[model samples]
Target: MEGKNIIYLNDIDGKTRAFTIKVKVVRLWKRSNPKKAGETWAIDMVLMDEKGTKMQATVWSNDFKKHEKILQQNECYTVFKPRFDKNNQKFKHFDTKYVLTFNLETTIRKCNNFIGPTHGFEFSTFKSIKNGGVSSEFRTDFIGYVEEWFAREDTTTRYGKQSYKMDLILRDLEGIALKLTLWEEYCDQMQEYISKNKEEEHIVLIVQFGSVHDYKGTINVANAYYITKLFINERNEEIVNFKRSYIGKASVTTSTHRSIGQSGVTSNEDEFLHNTTFSTIRQIREIAQVMHVIVVGTVMAVDKDSEWYYLGCESCNCKASPSLQFPEDDNGSDDVDPKEVLVCTNKKCKRDVVPAVHMYKVSIQVEDCTGIVNLTLFDRDTVKLWGLSAKQLVDKYLQVSDDEKTIPAEFNAFINKKYAFKIHVKKYNVDNKVDGFSINKLVDDPAIIAKLEKKFDVVPFEEFDSMILPTTVSSSQSDAGVKDSKSYAVDDSTPLPKNYESRKSPCDLKRTLEDSNDLDNSYSVSSTKSRKIETKEDIKAQMKDKLLIPKLEK
Candidate 1:
């Protein structure tokens, strides 16, 4: 609906037009240039009209100072003659294809009596998020209760600066759980709330416009760079209704796992195992997408052709494979030769030529009654089965044997041993029709194995080699045969992409209890202070070394 004098947000087309609209500044953030640090590129905002329709608006660097203080978030403003432009960014805030632009002729006037919604939140369902129904190009809102949480991790980033991160398992109203990761200041906000509200039984949290990610075979959600908002146990209608629905539910009980000096792998493995379904080795090969499954298989042989362990970065645990390192100061000695050392392949990692830790990367032939498949066991799961770190085993093997490819006696113990392996089937494996799988976790407990065997039908070990698969078992049939777990667990062992950027906090007006009814409470887990801009010299050095810093996702 359009009036004679005012225009709506959804009515404007990407063309030269003169229009006026009285809208509320739902959210606004300043984007910085990737090439020049601290240089503000544009002031972006999400504006909502009287009809609760949201649209993106932008104020360029030249006009940012003019409207920086004049336009406040959650405040009503009548913007006149704003230009319409196409939204061409790789990552956008909302589904609006066209964005409003502020030119030199654009006029802004405050509207104190404008009747409209202050916030626009379109919450997405767990079913959509779990099945890849939501587009990752745009962030979406999610509401869930915290079922379990891990301790806040205080670690150093590649920049040598200390950072904090925390992981939480969130469950929706339908008993569907998914992993959510909070980084940096977000971690502090949740930790502070937990410390203060230790007696709170149910903590219903809401994340507005959170980025959904699919790591390996697991689907998880995380707060993207500055644009995401958080609300935890707030006295709001949405959260109140959500908490009231789970009043008598025993499954919604919270459990906090303090991982201080404990093995982080145990929690990861437990979450993975709880979510994955049991399948035979033959069923795993027919997977159409990236999926994780449990299979009881016997280790037939250790693939000794490949190295069992690899040198990984000390800080990030990424594989490091740089060229041979020569002595910096040789003193003109010709007798000394260059020593080969493992360097972090991640360009962002500042620790250059540092010591590398030995991490397991063993491949073994695992055979079940259905079929035989190769499984690559990474460090954590390998340590769980071997009862020794890769470094310890390598050291012991080196003391006796010098050949790097030689199978150690310790590793041979896996041969002929039956264990339940959690296999991560990647998209690459499906597309390339590969039978190999990555072992994310392993279970050797006899009681647990017996229970799993009793639940699922398995052929005898004697007929494992001579087993014949049914030709009628299609990929759809295989998937439908197994029980799909509702838990959207995350695989933390996977590394983030090299070009992946971190989040930056956005500045907004903090709302009070008297803000508005039905949409009044929200706590942003972000700093309002400006982030430290990188110097041009620092950027130049990085550019010369081909080590560009990760930029904030806009």
Candidate 2:
């Protein structure tokens, strides 16, 4: 083989072995290290021979521009007089013990007769990655469909370098969802693909040389190194078969699964309904995000203190607050009507106040034997439950006497009534609880309620005690050294002791403390009159007696 001008990747050694071999550029990327001095960029590439042997190769910054355009991916090329270096195992992404480096004398020419393998990807399944035991130094290839993607965010790393990151939820053939992160150039590439192919559904993502990481208990895959490459919806036999077998036939149309009750009042209520698993209020609160669950509870009370309706702009349908402008001669009187004179806060809606529409924003507190939670019903769900629009409710309230400006009796019908709520739990954030609940479907059918009641009766509370219950920490046993101990009752209806203080949600307490701190930082004038300032000359004379004079050195 050596006499025929052919050398395999396994034959390469750190010695100055001169050879000409045909190989294909499998992957290539630029590596930038901020900690390095000038010219800190290098072009890295993975080359595979015709025999399926792979090795790492690099073009240093000085020679990168001259050879970068010549090294086309998947194209066969014959390299002459290439230098061999002992592979750095710590940064190696291939299986070879030696790596190739191009120098000033190294020459490369296109090999028309020989075509080598474009890539040597060893694909791994998400199940195997989740089971662990994979070496951190090893890089794996993965392929899946994009289940969902989040907007890209600019972030600053601890090294004081700026980069962009985007999160993607990838679903495998087995319907298991795994989170994949794209950083820097990869993020920009994916974002561009998404924007250009907005109408192209069923995009298959192929990630080569991605690192498997275990964050907390969830396993995910991310770009391993700078040379990690991404392919989207490429025309290949493996990807084509994957889509056909796992994602169904290409002729079949995929259904768009939108969230329930999001399509306004015209959407079919039954279309979004699901026969979800029954859970208690406590269980629902503790469940993970995006889970569909059914909770049966009685409306304990109506929080009328919160606004039942908000003024929204007609064009954008965004909530609008009243403008601060008022009549000069009004004398800050209460007779001024806000709805008649207010302006929409949305900058897009430059129209008058008459175009503002009324939207419902109702808050109801519901409770079961286990626990309690506040459910926020939006416009569509609010009208479905109350059988009246916010404008109609406002009209009815205005018909009553001026002294009775309270919530109408029609809204109070939900109090003390039992109903099963189908909800898709939003992700919980420690700083905000209001965004954690989204009511999907409201079920009032007696037969469905009866079936759920029978199902709950068969299951014992002890079964879910370990799974859904929130762990409690006693004050005496807490590691924070908190001495004031308090206990929470499972049954929310039970009255608390006189000394027991009610607990507020973390979000509410955080906001309250922040507001108090802002108030404390403001300067307050004690008197209505302003004090006169002393001139610089007056201050100098006043400090003359206190001023110290240094003696002259002899």
Candidate 3:
């Protein structure tokens, strides 16, 4: 821990176009409910570095598995041989930074500010503060308006202190909502109180300078500091360029306000539930932003500690009884028995979720063009979407399906459920709403499978066998080509009448094979001399007497 160098999350960010530095150790998280990402599973520090720089770090897979050591946050390490991510396509970001590897020689040094900088921004006008939160610091003062405020009593560990950081969702007259992150220190030492506040409220501020991090082309604020002394500027202060903002759910008003318009149609609620696309802007009324997100993948992993909170429906909640379960007192017994429960991670959906113990889960490392992220999936939600119970999958894959076995064994017997998420990839923090992704089946879709069956007439072997028999005779096929040999022609005296005409030429008379009763061969001869049946050679020879043509004699 002695010789380690100091660095920031931004010091070796993934925004570099040519080259970037790498940290020996870094922080990473996996989404807890991958189906809906509100929380994430915090994996202890594994060997990592600023990746957008080097070219040789591609073989980090083995190192990743081998360096699963218990490391602390805010620690620095010495990494070796990180590969330059030349294939910027490898991940979503167009960067020169690379991924690092941790070998046996890696050493970690604990440092302060594990959560990174305690940043602040100062602006001359609200417009100067366009779309607040962590972003590429503006070169000059920008201003906006305090459109809404979402505050709660939250315990965050920053600067070694557990305090509240105010989160403000502000919008300029342009009507775009900005996700604002506040510093915890201000909670203890602020001149104006934001509390006792309400929505549609207005606030003003002035801030100092900050950095403009491209963040892999997604410009955002980082390494930004606030001015200790500032004032509220209410007057029109040179409208700083419209907040460099992107639309997200922050502007999408809650479905709670949706009422049945006079048109006899449910407004936003229907759209939120049935429709797949929608938009929201605080004050801006025109632009109709469209977001299409759909994803289908298996629930590959789960980490319990990463979950935020669990709530069940009072009516449909599968829990034996709906009640809170706090820590046990002396006897290790909670006030209520949480025997079973359904907790939907997507609070807006409010559908009861499956109990953690009863759910199936899986893990997958998802990397888009934007960045790499670890994801977690819930068992029941995956099951509901994919239609594969854990037991069924385990039984097919592992040959263990009976419920009589241990619960874990039974759960493993079935195919885990799958889910899909609609995501808009960007360089910075991700905005995960319930509708961010789509849910779909992990196996072949039922509709397509059914259509194939109809087109190809595919019937199960069992049903086909029942409808047909192997030995049954078919009259149309069995009697084919069996000619009768007892025809009247076989009796030479039976067919010639008194007035039978003479044959036209020797060629007309039968000669070669024995023609007696050729019925079995499918050839029958009726003996009443009719036509001058002759080959073309014979006909030409008789052309001098052509008056008797083959059909004329008949």
lDDT winner: 1
Give the per-residue lDDT of model 1 (tens digit) for 1-554.
12235877778875537778889887778889978998989888878898888887889988876777797666677777888878887778788868788878888876544567535778999888999998888889999988778897888867998878999888888889989999887888888878765434457788987999887868889898777878886544466457656544432211222211122323423433465688765566456888778877667667756789988865556787867755422122345567665678889876565446677888787755444567788765565454566777788888888888877788767877777776777877677655556776566665555545543333432322223232344454434421111101111233333322221111011433322222111111111121111222322332234322333455
- The models' CA-based lDDT, in order, is 0.64, 0.59, 0.30
Candidate 3, 448: how far from true, in Å? Answer: 67
Q: How well does each candidate superpose onto the true structure, as a TM-score?
A: 0.44, 0.44, 0.20
RMSD of candidates 1 onward, in order: 28.2, 27.5, 31.5
Model 1 TM-score, 2 decimals: 0.44
What would the C-alpha RMSD of candidate 1 be, to one decimal place? 28.2
Candidate 1 structure lDDT: 0.64
lDDT per residue, candidate 3, 421-515, as tens digits? 32332211122111111121122243322222222111221122222223233554333211211110011123333322443321123432321
Which 10 residues in a row give candidate 1 its minimum summed lDDT?
Answer: 519-528
lDDT of 3 at 98: 38
